[model samples]
Target: MNRLQLAKRLAAMSVVLPAAASFIWEELLWLHALALLWLAGAAICWIGIERKHHSGQMRRTIHTLQAASNRTLNHHRHDWMNDLQVLYGYIRMQKPDKMVECVEKIKDRMAEESRIAKLGEPALIHYIQSFRTLTNAVQLRVEIAEGVHLTELPVDSSGISESLIEIMNAYRFAAAPALGEPAVLTMKLSMDDHALYAAFYYQGELTSEQRFASKINQQLEGAPLRPVEAGQPYGNMLLRAEWRA
Candidate 1:
């Protein structure tokens, strides 16, 4: 039951209470029974409110986490695609030195992003690692700090991943036909004792600013389940969500 339900029940009970008290055989018994009923109602109301609040918060938190995960996946996929393209060109041109250099650099970058593995969430990690076939022609790069670990992540991380996916997809879809290729979004993941952090840097130009902004606001729905910031060069975004250990 929610707050409205509890309120409705209380209203109904309030009407019944007067009739109930009047029918009691003794005044003392009526007084005691009425007091108990009122107390019960109040307790129910409080519980309803608390539950409702908790449920909403949980939903938002999960969604935010999921968005992060999805964006990370997409970014990884973008980078992997670039590597494949470079390899294809190198193999065709027979440029051994260039191929080796690029391959080594990619390896280094992958190692840096691998720090997210310490977050202790397999589903999210796997999903992020397999980012490909995104809704838009966007590039994503995920980087994680060294020696950073988030020991106790929630069992389900799809919510935040989904949030990120939604944002990107919406932005790309809203871009006009003339807008052409999507921008690159660099995602960096980190965490402290209290929160998980996701910092985004976008490096693409949108044809229609108003349309993109409108789509983004609609996608986010203005609910910061976690603290977030957005502004500056190319409108980068940040999310800092508390994590409980």
Candidate 2:
């Protein structure tokens, strides 16, 4: 441990040991008061130490989040630059067909991003939008049905967001990187008259299929939505879940 931690432990031991001895062999009233004073000092020291540790943790978390945000912004900027370069190249080559295709792709991507932003849960929106910058192990394709807002549902939004993040993490950690290209994970969110549906389609190689399935199941335990089914069809994994209104 660091010197600060070692010192705190030493200080705690000194006060506690003296207090214990005083209680065991005290012959005077003043000795009891001294023991109580030592006990109070120990408590104060413990509270201070805990507060300091928590404050440090909070600062670190903020720093990490800021760094991630900066990275995501850079990635987005780079993507736009590349897109513009491609469009410029197409225009210079006098190829109108490829230029139209590239513009359509950009429009679609922006529309999807706009939908994700209005998902009604800040945490889930951030998680989904920043996921690309978080890792390179998986390519995430999120499809949110038009007019579907998560907050409109009667279920717990936070729980749904947490469960979705955990599910994504399961695939992210289980996918084999060296086997081939990064895996593609598609998440489709749709709503019906009485329920909401989330379907996960994973098309890629996993280090261990059983382990990935186990992790997904474990993460979904006690989640807001119930698992409808998990199966493999055409050598691809499909997991479906639904939340009734």
Candidate 3:
């Protein structure tokens, strides 16, 4: 086990040992007071240690998130600058069609991002939007079907959000495409018959297909969503999940 878990176990043992001693030694009944004091001290120390560990974890999480945020901002800035340069070059060349196409691409990207932001879960939205900055293992595209609001659905929003995150993580880490080719995963979220559905279309190779399938199954255990169908069609993996009320 990790050091933190080990330390917690030791602290618990310390508290339990004293109580056990008091209970075992009848003649040391008078020592019950001492044992009680020892237990109390140990419990307080355990609490302090737990709090300190959690505080450190929180700080680390915040720092990592801030770093991710900064990277995302820088990447976006670079992309915008590139787009502007392309637009400027098109203008200089008097290529109106190319310029229009570039502008349309930008607009489409903005519209998709807007829909992602409105997914109704802050963590899900942030994770989806910042996924590219976090990793290049998978080229991820998330599309939310129009008129679907996760928060408005009569289902477990947080659970669904967490499950989707887990599902993405399974694919993200397992992604290992062939030489000179990157893995691509397109996720489409939609609602049907008062139920939420997520469909993942993956185009690439995995280092270990069995391991990836195992990870997906493990994450879905007891989750709010369950797999509807998973298969490989025309050499591509397609996975679909439906929210179970």
Q: For candidate 2, lDDT tens digit of each residue in 113-172? A: 899987799888878878898778889999999976778667677788888888888878
Give a tens-digit lDDT track for model 1, residues 1-245: 86666675665566566556656745677676776777677667767766877789899999987887777667767878999899889989999999999899888876765675665556545544544444455555677776445444631245555555566565456444436665666777776666667676776666777777666666557433243655423357777766644
TM-score of 2: 0.84
Scored by TM-score, the top model is: 2
Give the alpha-carbon lDDT of every model: 0.64, 0.79, 0.80
Greater lDDT among 1 and 3 belongs to 3
Over 75-169, each residue of candidate 3 has an lDDT whose tens digit, in order, gives 87898899989999999999999999999988988888888878899899888878888677788888888866777677778988998899888
**What's the residue-level lDDT of 5 in candidate 2?**
79
In candidate 3, stretches whose alpha carbon ends up further than 4 angstroms from where it belongs are 1-53, 230-245
- Number of backbone-clashing residue pairs for each candidate, in the order shown: 18, 0, 0
Cα error, residue 198 of model 2, in Å, equals: 1.0
Error of 3 at 10 (Å): 11
List the pairs of residues colliding in candidate 3: none
